[model samples]
Structure formats: C-alpha cells, structure tokens
Target: MIFIRKSNDRGRSQTKWLSSFHTFSFAGYYDPKFIEFGHLRVINEDTVQPGFGFEKHPHSNMEIISYVVEGSLEHRDSIGNGSVIKPGELQIMTAGTGIEHSEFNHSQMDLLHFLQIWIVPEKTNLTPSYQQITINKVLNQFVLIGSQNKQDGTVIIHQDVNLYVAFLTRNISIDYSLKANRKGWLQLVKGKIKLNNQTLLVGDGAAIQNEKINLQCIEDSELLFFDLSSN
Candidate 1:
C-alpha cells in the first residue's frame, strides 16, 4: 500500500528567520493521522534566513539526522562535536540519555535549507554520540547514507532502519523491493518524481508497506528512501 503525505498538507511553522514544514507531529504541529510511520518520528523541512538559525536545544533517546540541501549548516553539540555540513553531506546525532545542540547557517549571505529527521531508538539510555559523512549521490543509484550497522561506511543509527539517497535526471527510473513485514518511506527533496505511478513534488512524502517501489524521474531530482521495521 502507498499512502501519500502531500506537500501542501504539511503543517508549517514560520518565524522571522525560520520556515519549517513538518511531515509528522512536531513542536507545534500535530496531526493525529500523521503522528508517525513506524519508528520514523519526525521529518522537518527547514529553511533559515541569512545569519540566522536554531539556538541550543535538548533532545533525548532519539536518532537525529541532518541533510543539507543548500548552503552550509554549522552544528555544535554538548558532546564536543562541532562541524559545518555542506550540501552532499550527512550528519547523525544519537541523543541517548540527553544532549544539547545548536544549528546555524554558516553562510551569512545564502539561505540555509535542510531536512531534520528523528527516529526512535530500539532501546533507551545509551550514550550520546555524533557522526558526519560526505556522500556523493549517483544518478539512478541508491546510496546508503545511514543504517543500523554502518553499511558501506554509512553512519550507524540505533534502530532497525536503512536510509538511502539518490539523485536522478529526467526520464531515469529505479526499483526497490521491501522485505516482508518491512515498511518504507520516501521523501522528495527537490523536483518531481513518480513513485509507483503516484507523483510527488518537493516536500512530499509517501508511506509504503509490503510493496515494491518503482520510481521514475519527471525532472532532475533528489530523494531519500527509508527501509524500516514493521514495528
């Protein structure tokens, strides 16, 4: 089954410096029907104005992932990990126990665009940690960016999930099969694409279960695919 979460239907939070669209319940956005998809908790598409960003905040027992779409993201956390994430890079912060973090736009002249994802951990109270990796997306091919076991040098997350990304050009197509009892979530980062005959535009998402995903690019696009446990 394929259930779509349309771009226009997502909840929005806008401030003088920030604009965020939530795919699930988050902060001040709540939709009972879209609370979550399996263990995938939050998917926030955010844009920050020049010289502005998020200040220190705390989180616990959640696997937080960051993917920058444009500009540079400066991240600093209580765990002594600090870095600048540019386009084509991925960062993960395991907020086990608890942690305080801040994210800002490194470029004072360009708007910062990114996605913030949260996944519930399989177990709680583990030590907090952070990791960042450079990922080069290949056309029409799945690139493993995060997984339970750090597959293909991807960052490790404390959950039964695998995150993949791909960049596609017009007319390209790809296929992925889900194992029995597994679940899938697809997020369209940029441009348009057709997922199993259903079209998705920027900021759109789809939930899948017990199905094979067929994707065809309607234009140049970037996307994220998640393979998750049924639980």
Candidate 2:
C-alpha cells in the first residue's frame, strides 16, 4: 500500500530568517493523526537566511540527520565535532544521553536550504556520537546516506533505518526492491518523478509498504528514500 503526503498539506511556518515545513508533528504544530510513522519521527524542510540559525539546543535518545540541499550549514556540537556541510553531504548526530548543538548558515549571501530528520533510536543512553560522510562517490547510484553501522560508507545512526539519496537525469529510471520486512518512504526534493505510476512533484512524499517500487525520472530529479525496519 502507498499513501501520499502532498507538499501543500505539510505544516508551514515562516519567520523573518527562517522558513520551514513540517511533515510530521513538530514543535507547535501538533497533529495527533500525523504524529509519526513507524520509527521515523520528524522531517523538516528548512531554509535559513544569512546570519541566522538555530542556537544551541538539547536533544536526547534521538538520531538526528541533516541533508544539505543548497548552500552550507555550519554545525558545532558538545561532542567536539564541528564542520561545514554542503550539498551531497550527510551528518548524523546520535543524542543518546544528551547533547547540545547549533546549526547556522555558512554563506553570507545565499540562503541555506536543507532537510532535518529525526528518528527514534533503538537503544537509549548508549553514548553521544557524531558522524559525517561525503557522498561525492555515489552521485551515479542511490547513495547510502545513513545507516546503523560505521562499516557502511555512510553516517551511522542509532536506529534500524537506512537513508538514500539519488540524483537522476531526465528520462532515467531506477528500480528498487524492498526488503521483505521493511517499509519505505520516498520524498522528492526537486524536479518531477513517477513512483509506481504515481506522479510526485517536488516536496511531495509517499509512504510505501508494498513489495517493490519503480521510480522513473520525468525530469532531472533529486530524491531521498528512507528504508526502515518494521520491527
């Protein structure tokens, strides 16, 4: 089964320096029916103005992952990790016990656009950790962006989920076979695509519990897919 979450249906908030859309219940936008899907908790599409950002905040028992779509985000955390993440880079911070961090736009002129995702960790009170991976090598295939193990060529999270990003040219097609006991969430970041005969535009998403999926790029498209364990 596949359920569609239209882009316009997401909760939206706009500030002078920040514009954000929430896919699930987050902050002041509470919707009981849309609280969360499986272990996937939060998906926020954010655009930040120059010289603006999120101050140091605390989080616990949650795996936070950030994917930069445009511009750059400077990240600093209590775990002694600091870096500037640009497009095609993924950062994962496991706020196991407790951690404080800040994210700011690194560009002085260009606005920073990105996606922030949070997933419930499989185990709590493990340890606070951080990981960043450059995805320049996987521009051709569906690159693994997030995983639960450091052995993979991606950032490790304390969750039983896998995040993938694909950049496909116009008229290209990609087929994905879902695991027997796993589910999938597909989000179109830019351009247009057809997933199993269903057309999805930019910002649109679909939750798939089916056996397989066929994604056809109607236009040059950039998309993100999350494969989550059912257990």
Estimate TM-scores for all models: 0.98, 0.96
| lDDT tens per residue, model 1, 1-231 | 899999999999999999999999998899999999999999999999998998999999999999999999999999898999999999999999999999999988999999999999999998999999989667788888899996665999899999999999999999999998899999999999999999999989999987888999999999999999997
Give me the runs in candidate 1 sitting further than 4 Å from their true place: none
Q: Residues 1-231, candidate 2, lDDT per residue (tens digit)?
A: 988899999999999999999999999898887898889999999999997999999999999989899999999999899999999788888899999999999988999999999999998896998888888544436887678776666787778888888998888888888888899988899999888889999899899996588888899889889999977
Kindly give the stretch of ten consecutive residues in candidate 2 with the minimal lDDT sum.
Answer: 136-145
lDDT agreement of model 1 with the native: 0.93
